[model samples]
Each structure stands twice: as structure tokens, then as C-alpha cells.
Target chain A: MEIYRYSMYPLGLKKLIVPCRQLQAFLQDLLESTDHLKAVLVTDKDGVILAKATGPDLPDHVLEPAFSATFSVASDQSGKLGFGRNKMIMSTFDEDQVVQFNYSPLILTLLASSKANSGVLIAAGKDLEEPIKIVGESVSKAIQHEHKAKEYV
Target chain B: MLKPKVITQVLQQANTAGVHAALLLNPDGSLVSFAGGTEKDAKVLAAVASNVWFGYERYGKPPAANSVEGGEGKEGLRNLILDCEQGKLSITRTSRMLLCLVADERVEWGLLKAKTRTLKEYLEGPLNLVASY
Candidate 1:
């Protein structure tokens, strides 16, 4: 029977390949100037994390649920609440968090301190749009390539 | 003529009841008919169809079984209707056309259900007739 479980990218994709490293560096640079950015993760519409940036000590398992919940909340709010395509979702408590879904499939989620500058965060997000789109498209291609490789084996 | 008339009727019904918006989309997530008052972007229809496809694949039963049951009954592959505070979406089985209605959360559920019932009947007759021919 077929099982449904989250699978990681193949070893070829995992190797410090040019595209993968560039994506990581691009994300790290994108978040560097933003203050109190606790974490940033990019995931597909199906809740698969394509890439993530977090503190060194952060565990791996937390990424999946965080991305899934954020996507669900954003999609639900857009559908139910009149959020107008759900460009951005901000949740402010002891800390500030922002989740943005662009181009229908790619999601960029960020966690920051309450004192973080909302304007800066929004600006940085806007600037990252092109890079994010490139990364998302590349990741999608990589996934497709991996699938084809598996089928041939 | 048939498509536009259907659009007009659905919009009129939704407007009389103070709904937000309504739309009709083809199986490939393209707009075939639209009504009501709201943004008329094609993206909205695509988004709604994407969600509907996801819901059907995840929670819905098999397509053939759903058709058999819906056809035997009056449902006619009516699939699922999602209710949101801003709007609701209903997909028809025959051509995979979607009827999306946006309304205030305050709108009465019973009233909406009644309207959908009327729509289902109207669509079922014409759709089944076309299928047989």
C-alpha cells in the first residue's frame, strides 16, 4: 500500500549544489537586515518546506507544523474573512509574526519580536518577491526532476 | 444565450438576498459565467477551483461514486459547497463549472440553502438533458 509521508529531496539536490546554495544564501541575505527575525521558512502549497532559515539550535521537526498551520490559517482567512488574496497575514502578541503567500503556491513565513519595525519587514518582504519567485520555480523544477529520476530507477 | 441567462438568474437571486459575489468557472478553472458585485478578476475563479479540487481530492469520495449518487438523487455531482464569512463556492459536476457566491457572514444560512436548492434543480434539468443528447 502507498503511504503518505513527508520525504526529503534526493541526495543530488541536497548536495551543496549551486542552485541550492544560492537559494540558501539568497534567503539568509534577505533576512539579515530585518531585526528580530526569529525565523523564516518557505513552503509549497502542499505544506512542504522548500527552504528555511532559523537559529542554529532550532530543531527540524518544528518546521513542518509551523508551515502547515500558517498556510491553513492564511488560506482560511482569505477565503472566509475578506482578506483580498491574502498578501500578508500579521499576528502580533508578545512577538510579531508575518506570513505572506505569493504566486498561489509559495509561502514566506517570518517570526519577529513585537518591537520589530513593521515597515522594514514589509519592505524587505517586497524586495524579496523576485528572488522568492525564482527560488520557488527552481525548487518545483528540482522536485519534478527528482520524481522523474525515481521513476526511471 | 443560455450561459448569460444562467449568470443573470444566479446574480439576481444572490443580489435580492444581499450576497457579495458569484461566479461560474469551467473545468480547467476558466470563467464561463459570472455575476453579482465584486472583483471580476479571473484569478479569483482560479483560486476557488484550486481549493475545490484540493477539497475533493482530500475529503471527497471517488468521482464515479459521487456521480452515481448525485445523478440518482437530485444532486448531480453537485460536489461540495464551502461557506466562508466573505463568500461561498458551489461546483457543478456536469461540466466542472463552479458557482461562487460571496456574502456577509450575517446572511441567513437557511436562505442560502434554499437558493442553492433552486439552482441545483435548474442546473440538473438542463445539464442532464444535454448529457443524454
Candidate 2:
């Protein structure tokens, strides 16, 4: 429900600035496009909430950033064993609530009911990968821009 | 000591379904049993997994640690799955124990994950693993 805004560099590759407005619009489209997703939270490597969209029955407390941060550590380690970098983490909690996470230039936390189709949830996460990259880069740019402005003042 | 044969059977069963390796660990990360990997590999898996379980239990809050007294099963973490470029890993837990499965990239994960409860039962029953870690 609460969305955090940040400017992260995309995969730490190309440096580009994506406007915060664009990020919000992308989140909106993702929500409308996916019927099964109950909520989505975007966070940085530190597990700080950047931007999020929530549906019914979701509150801030349930969308903890600390849990999301651990995935990043797992992701980094996975790449070391000659395996590719980690793409996502899926956890099924009690009563069939399923949570899926994707780590990268951005970390995505998704929640859905136990009855929701697993395929649909996975596809939805894949669909948002690009948009999240751009949004993440936008956050980095925002922070950098703020720092620059401070220097001039 | 837990029966090695039953633990081996469970690991082999998991391997049949494509979980290349599996292990049981105490909350502190000591190796209880392992299936499908070299001894060195098993040690690596145990070391990393116990740390993960410990961190999650100690710091992952609101839902808090599942081991916390009176915490509902649904309140905290139940299972965790990760898909990396090369392979996949899944970790499930009890109050005092952890089950980690390390599988190859081609594994049929959904089927394997669906059977985690049965594996946990194997640990608790014939394997005689203590649940109070």
C-alpha cells in the first residue's frame, strides 16, 4: 500500500534516470495486468521499501523489508558456485498464501492467495522485470540528483 | 544417533525426483544427515543453510521466528525456494531443525516441493530426529 521511491542504477550497468512518475505508472499497469497478484513491493538491496502496490488484506507489517534483503544475499552466493545468479525465491506460508521474490537491479516481493494459479504468479513477476529495472535506476538518479543539488547550494 | 539408512533413503528418494542433494541440520548448523553430494559439498550446504535459518529466526519479525513460543505456523516462514542461474535450493524448517534441498537446474521443483512435509516426517519418525533443537 505504501510505496517508497528510489533511484537505483539498472543492474549497475547503464546509468539512466527513470522518472518516478513513470515508475508509478508501470506499477499501475502491472497491477491491472495481473489478476492473481494480491500485492507487490519493490525494495533496494538493503531491504528498504522503494515502491509498492497493495490489494485487499495486505498491510505494511506483512510486507517486511528484512525478509526481502536475505534473498539478495542468497542471490549473490548462488552465483558463486558456477550457478547463475539467483532470479527469484518462492515461499509458501500457512493456509496457502504464496509469496514470490525476484532479486536484481530491483527486488520484487509478491503475495497471492493459495488458490491463485502458480503459473500466473510467475509470469506476472517475469513481466515486470524490465519496468522494475528502470524504476530502480530512477531511484538512483533521484538520490544522485539530490546530492548534486545539495553541493550547489 | 539418527538412522543413516532411513536418512539415506529419504535423500535417495529426493534425488530420484531430481533434488541432487539434501541435508538435515540442527539450528546451529551441525550436519545431521546428507544425501546426493560429496562430503565436501554437504559441508558447504550445511554451513550456509544453518546461517540462513538462524538469521531468519532471529531477525525476521512481525511474523517473527516460527520457533517463538505461541507463534502460529502461518505467522512466520514456512518454506523458502531460490532459483539461481545454475540450480535451485529449497529450505523448510521446524522449531529446532532445518531441511535443505539442493537440486540441479533441471529438477521438477514443484513436485519435489509439494512433498516436503513427507520428507520432514521421514526425519521425525524413522530417522528419530529430535524436533526441539
| Candidate of highest TM-score | 2
| Model 1 ranges off by over 4 Å | A1-17, A56-64, A76-84, A146-153, B1-133
TM-score of chain A by itself in each prediction: 0.68, 0.70
lDDT of 1 by residue, A13-130 (tens): 5542465457667678766766776567776666666676775544444343444444454355456334244454333332234434454457776655556765566677667678
- What is the clash tally of candidate 1? 2
Error of 1 at A143 (Å): 3.4
What does the lDDT read for residue A44 in candidate 2?
Answer: 79
TM-score of each: 0.43, 0.76
Candidate 1 TM-score to native:
0.43
DockQ, prediction 2:
0.45
Stretches off by above 4 angstroms in model 2 are A1-19, A32-36, A77-82, A96-103, A140-153, B58-74, B127-133
Work out the iRMS of candidate 1. Answer: 14.9
Q: For residues B1-133, what per-residue lDDT tens digits would candidate 2 score against the true structure?
A: 5567776777677776567888887767788778887988787777777775555544443342223344443346677766776788778884467888887778766766766666876665543444544
